[model samples]
Target: MTPILLIEQVLNGLQSGIMLFLMAAGLTLIFGVMGLINLAHGSLYMIGAFAAAAVAGWTGSFTLALAAALAAAALAGCIIEMVVIRRLYDRDHLDQVLATFALILIFSEGTRWLFGSFPLYLDVPAALSGPVRLPGGILYPSYRLLIIVIGLLIAIGLFQLIARTRIGIQIRAGESDREMIGALGVDISRLYTIVFALGAALAGLAGALVGAIQSVQVGMGEPVLILAFVVIVIGGIGSIKGALVGALLVGLTDTLGGVLLPLFFGLFMDPSSATTIGSALASMSIYILMALVLLFRPTGLYGRA
Candidate 1:
């Protein structure tokens, strides 16, 4: 209702969208270039959170925790790519899906066993722990603001890497014609591994950054993973630009719908019924957006036909 509240919600949406973009960016890249449906991607997210929490606990420093998380997730991704995902490239999507699903089970249970089903807590670094006053005198969490800044920076960096760098050129080429790149001595196999690991690291970073605000627990990445899928689907597969737009759209839709839908319904319906029904519909809003996007552009807003 209030302008400040509305601004706060927008910030929330932006934060959520950025995180979704981080997850979706890698997902789209993997699907576009490698043609693998990695259901285990969420598992890498969880691994990163756990790794960060564990390292932070041991070292009492968020920086070390983040470093450990990124490295661990990236390393894990490389191993998975080399040992498990490599065989699936030549196989069907169903096979890749099933294998990755199994990987989720292994990762979840392994983490539970190691961490003993207890959730770990990550603290925002002391420097980033407070609130910053924004224009119009609204205060926002520094950590959340940091997330937005980091996400945008990463987005820019990714754009530059893909558009300006040699590796980006190779990645584009590989996406268009893997065989041609292989023939050109691009080391397609190694590239695939590096891409997977890079994606894993991004997801890991998302988990670590988000873990500071939420509990570091098992299966935390699943919901975000689903949302990330929706984001990429709406944005268009294999398009980073699409992923960024789609993620923001989803974030704003989900956040605003959750807050505003119930209010709108309460005007005409009983308050209790409006709250329940509105909540349900709000949760479904992004999927409906996805459906509409698919209706008009099945490949996504930025995805190539």
Candidate 2:
């Protein structure tokens, strides 16, 4: 591949990493603070996308769509928490898993019922629809660059929120000891709702942002949700730092492997055969990385020592 193509793929990988970070950050927080394994977290992402699409269709404005998406997702999360998820909190992981899985089904069918099976489309805003030239005369999509910027900003905002704020301290405390926090009059239940809502909002934002590039439809978040799981697994159960590193690792590994492995294999085999073999390996690259990380640091890179 040409240097320009390679550079483009690198940028693509970074964008993908940022997207994964958006989803995984919330997943890690939910797991860390609530100790709840929400399989339907991806559904929240879907909700965000659909909400954005509907609003954008109505208003013809991307910014308004995004705002509606965040609000809708946050509101949906709070409602779900109050009505269904709260009960699952005191239950076992198996119960939480089952309940959330049911949520996925409900969300998928509900979306289909509302929007039909046809996928909705989101256009890149006019301001970011073009490409910018790089130093090497390579052009890159402005939208992808925007994704990276937004992702980094969210990461910084998250770090500040969790590390420096009072709510962050309460969340960390809740993670460490729920009962003790309640005993100290922290209103652990309310805190749990807030944390869950935040996670859901992040997931929603990711979905809406990505919907502009991909088709928005039922079950759209499932694939990314699985990748986000891999991210959390590699990052650790409850560590934000781990999620960031692990997401970037997975994103870059997956992207580079898909591109470079074929080239590497082509050196020794026919192009077709090389592509076949390379594709399989590329798909497995993140899993291999996950395994290697686990073998060395079972808890993940930024997990507790």
Candidate 3:
């Protein structure tokens, strides 16, 4: 492959990874701070996409669409946390899983009921619809590049939020000792709701960002949810830093393996067989990477032992 093509793919991978980080960051934060296993997290993502789509269709403002996404998802998250998830904190993971899985179905059907089975499209804003030339004589979608920049900025913001803010300290403290934090006058329930909502909002933002590139439809978040899970697992269950690193690794491996494997096999075999085998193996590449990481570092790349 040409250097230009390879670089483009890498950029694509980076963009994908950044979106994944958006999803995984909230997930890691939620789990770390509240110790909740939220299977319905993907449903929140879908909700954000639908919210953005509906808002954009009505107002024709992409900015408003994003704000709608963030608001809808966060509000939904707060409602669920207060109504359903709050009760599940003392329950085991199996119960939490079953409950959240039910929430997923409810969300999917509810979305379909409201939005219909047809997919909605999110148009890139005019200002970002055009491509910009990169230094290596590369042309890439400005929207995608913006996604990367925005993701990175959010990442830095998250780091600062965790390190500098009073809320950040509370979140970290809550993670280590929830009961103790509550005893110290912190409203544990309020804190949990806030954390859950924040996580949901982040997931929604990811959905809105990605919806521009793809059809906004019911069930779109499930695939990304699976990848986010892999990201958290590989990065450690509660580590944002780990989530970012693991997401990039998974994103690059999945994207590049799909592209390179067939080419590599084609050099030694017939094209058709190469394509079939390469595609199959490429699909497994991320799982393989996850397994490799778990082999030696059972806690994950940045997980505490």
lDDT of 2 by residue, 109-179 (tens): 99999999999978878899999997998899898999999999999999999999999999889878888
Error of 1 at 99 (Å): 0.4
**lDDT tens readout by residue for model 1, 1-305:** 99999999999999999998999999989988898888899999999999999999899999899899899999999999999999999999999999999999999999999997889888899999999999899999999999999999999999999999998998899889889999999889989998999999999999999998998999998888999889989998888899999999999999999999999999999999999999999989999999999999988899899
Each candidate structure's count of clashing pairs: 1, 0, 0
lDDT of 1: 0.93
- Cα deviation at 226, candidate 1, in Å, is 0.9
TM-score of each: 0.98, 0.98, 0.98
What's the CA error at residue 179 for candidate 1, in Å? 1.3
Worst 10 residues of 1 by lDDT: 170-179
Ranking by lDDT: 3, 1, 2
lDDT of each: 0.93, 0.92, 0.94
Q: For each candidate, C-alpha RMSD in Å?
A: 1.0, 1.0, 0.9
Deviation in Å, model 2, residue 294 alpha carbon = 1.1
